[model samples]
Target: MMVRFRPTILRQYLLQGQLPTTGCLRSQARLPCIAARNRGAYLLSYAPVRAIHSESTPTASNGPADPAFVPLRKLLKDEAKKQKLSGKKKKKNANNQVVEGWELTVGIEIHAQLNTAKKLFSGATTSFNDHPNTHVAYFDLAIPGSQPVFQKETLIPALRAALALNCDIQQVSTFDRKHYFHWDQPSGYQITQYYEPFARNGVITLQARDGIAVEDGEGISVGIKQIQMEQDTAKTLAQLDNVHWVDFNRVGVPLIEIITLPEIHHPATAAALVKKVQVLLRAVDACVSGMEAGGLRADVNVSVRRSDDPSAPLGQRTEIKNLSSFKAVEDAIIAERDRQIAVLESGGTIASETRGWSIGSTETRRLRGKEGEVDYRYMPDPDLAPIVIGEDLVQHLRETMGELPDAEVDGLIEDFKLTPKDARSLVGLNSGMGVEYFWNVVDALKHRLGSSSLADNLPCYQLAANWILHEFGKLWFDEHEDDAARDFGFTEDGQCARVPVDHLADILFFLYRSQITSRIAKEILWAVFRGRVPAEYASVRDVIDTEDLWFRELSDAEYAALADEAVKGQESVVRVFMEKQEKYPQGKLMFLVGRMMRLGPEERIDPRSAERVMRERIEERYIPRLRGE
Candidate 1:
């Protein structure tokens, strides 16, 4: 069915004019009448504004006003009405489900916890993993008689994060109060941006397997609606059997809320968008960006409607929250879409509400209905002054933003001449490289081997990459063995062993460049790691370390006795060399040289050099026919 929105509402839908989101702005903007007719509908008329003699102080909990709206609200309400009407007359689909190939419109709101040394308003530390409540200050805890003092350090990271996402920075922006009630929130309402966000009109470029893709621009532009700095609520932990504990340590931590337009369609795209944002956040060093740690959280809004009907508006959307994992987020969206479709097919009305995903059941369970917007009762924070972004601040932040993950990955591929797949694997290696140290280790190995040209040799690079990730990684991170017992104990995973880069380079050079067998080099490496002398030594730590070399510990008297005995016993094998110089060559006499080298377990002889010396001596003394000729 065709539906038309009133001029004011349509203006907001097209984003033609900015709407007042604050309670103060909402009261001044007059409401308009919404008219709907079947099959084809147009705006019949809008209610004229009734001018009041004098204005009254706006209260926080002002009930719904008559025909009330600014632009965005009017558009949202008109669209909601159209969706509600379409649901009543919509035909039932098969399997009591929304038909396959149903068009789904997706949008994302990403909240990143800003990385900082201190809380937004308090001097308490913002670092993670501290003892619970250790980082809380009076303001952070929302203690009685406490006032907030805004921190510039908090805002700097948000700006950097927005820039990393390829967002346009707004020169002018303001904050508002977002209201709700919870024990975790000691503050009645959160100070956020309802007027002007710090970042807007940003586009993110992400590379999927197929080609380069932008989150916005395809259909919805997934355009960045806004990014604002706010404070985080306290963490709540619920244990077994209905016991709950609140950790106020995280309260008032600085955070960034990034809202996207309705553009994303596929589940993979949603996951990709999340991952891309994660990279940018980590690159900026703002917010830990670790999913397990809840440094970042995403709320997904999904709506499924018929592609066949252009006139019919979008279906009612369910807001799915608490989706911490990428897989969970996608699954929740799909499940919610299916649930909405099922409700429509069963001839039931779908209510607009917030829902939580139950991963165990693979369903979106409703948490709340179209609830009234509680008055956060926003007013200018008297305790804190407004932040002004100066040219130097912007310039400094721009420099700190650094290259984002996608750009860095591209550099790795271009600079190292890595294949696309290899580059991707490396970028995603070890849950994605979060710091420079990981990349440095790989580069150090590459440089040491002088294998710069061998990067295109993927098999060789893979071999090297794996060893660093596994062997070196194991030394620090692997808990199976404690290195305190071992000679070298590098406390952290990144610092595996202090084995110099040049030393490793020499070992690899011997194996690959000098053509030493890998087996022999490995033996040498083992001795080096154990702090043993070169294998030419006979004894180590008062033990015969190996049978190969045996003369180091023994005195001069023992070497003399063994050499005399070897000279007497090997004359028989030496006699044959004189009789048949034509039949027995160096190859045949090498066996006898091997025998003499093993004669003294106390002798430390270079095996190859000794064999050459023995052959030359035998040829000179015993080969009579060849010598005379």
Candidate 2:
């Protein structure tokens, strides 16, 4: 049999110094206690009958008797003091010397907006820059009789992101209500996966860069606590005079929040980790990952502790919130870490609080006291049912998971024998489109060159990479200098709109064969990009012929005659070379070659060829006479 006891009756009995003789009297189960006046409800988990032997409790000798009550105020105060002292002790050594410096510990929470046509829970279009509240629906406004309908489009990208991060995707996950009171949150609760996240136990390994602890070719791994799907809040516009405005168009947009463990030791490591996530998300088409437009942002939690004390508990962390840029994230972590160390070293305690990153000043400003888990009052949402992933769904997502950034980078390094830096630059092209364009050009060149292997054609690969990254990249950027949203070689619809990949390959092919100099190649590229070249001239050779830009190597007889004329024209230089042959042999010969190239040709001549012919003529004809041989 089961019995229930009202909390009021239990509280009265405890206050009256009476022990109930009934079921669960000796049980260790927690019982709720409701108190009168200023005291609120509390749970009494340890109710020992031995402490209350008699119905009437004995009065204290030095104070009024209240034997049933134990005030938690003094106990909490003592615990706080003990914890503070323990933290301080860890900063000192056996000689009681304070440690020279503190270690910085950082963790980041990234919120990436999922790419979809509609809002996550409503049918409103997800287009940006619409009139304020124009795209909002009844569900987005959280009206009296409205409910959210989940969007299936959000799951694919979310799953792809989980796989990219090496996360363990859960077969089953549930949503919860994260309660908070804010004007921006019209619903007063955000629908998020709090109890069981979609994925967990993931890792993101970052290659060492500037300000990070690890060296080049070395990496540091950070643990991913979880990745959860959550709804975005409305954008608050506080710059208006006398009234604040809210934009609900962004409300109900889907986001996947990736929470990392506190393993970062430097600001740069955190930034690098964020950048890696951005690249992965973009590669998988999970998000646009635009920080400036608020598609991606980070909340960085920073703390400082003694580097010597690995076992010591971490210092009270201050979270720098809503850092929209990588530079802001890194700078904010650095500033917060320094502030925390300065506080501890000056005999002050670090407060557990939430801070705002001041982008302009590069500092962290106090926002609010940190909130505990209980403060949110999380509960499973009754409206939405739990989602279950079957084997078929997981298999489909895995099968379609395209090449991620790291894998692509490694492939470029191995197959093309490109350096890690160059390979990384290629994979990082236009958030991976550059890689697509690069390989497309390579394949086209292979067909043209009658080669079946990229590895077999190292020169072609090198030339393609160099021209695409340096020359083509410059032209692409220059064409879209005013449009920040323009992607390389792609239109807004994601079509290949810039110079065709095949055309670029033809240009590189001509360059590889030395039929045209780099200057002519660049000019041909620009002409094609600007549509100045006619369609009939499809290949680089045709373009060179049509535009009359082909360069010719000088014939030996022509070069001999030109060199003789150049020596006669620059007699002073020839005399100097003859007088000081030991000091200026090669230099004097090259001077004659340069003068001959300038004076001999209406058509451009190859400089190297001219130099060779000039050297042969001078050594056989001029040098013999100069040395009296």
Q: After superposition, how far is residue 105 of candidate 1 from its true place, in Å?
A: 1.4
Candidate 2 wrongly placed segments (more than 4 Å): 1-100, 209-217, 238-243, 479-495, 534-541, 555-629
| Native-referenced Cα lDDT, model 1 | 0.60
What lDDT tens digits, residue by residue, belong to model 1 across residues 1-629? 11222444333422234453533333333333223334223233332221110023223333122333345446546655775776743222212223465777778988888878888788878856654454567776566898887777788788888887768787777777777776567676777776677888888765554121233233322477788888888876543333334566778888898888887766657766776677667656666656767888999988888777856887777788867877566667667877877877788877878889753334688898744444445565556555667767778888866566666677766765665655555555433441243454456656755565545444444444544344444444545545652434322233334433334434444444333434454545455454454344432222223533222333444444444455465666666777664576666566665555678541344455455556655665445533564
Model 2, residue pairs in steric clash: none
RMSD of each: 21.4, 20.2
State the lDDT at 76 in candidate 1: 47
The residue pairs that clash in candidate 1, if any, are 31-67, 115-287, 216-221, 217-221, 550-602, 551-602
lDDT of 2 by residue, 166-242 (tens): 99999999999999976667688999999899899999887743224442137878899999999999876532123
Q: After superposition, how far is residue 425 of candidate 1 from its true place, in Å?
A: 4.1
TM-score of 1: 0.61
- Give the range where candidate 1 is weakest over 10 consecutive residues by summed lDDT: 46-55
Candidate number of the best lDDT: 2
lDDT of 2 at 608: 76
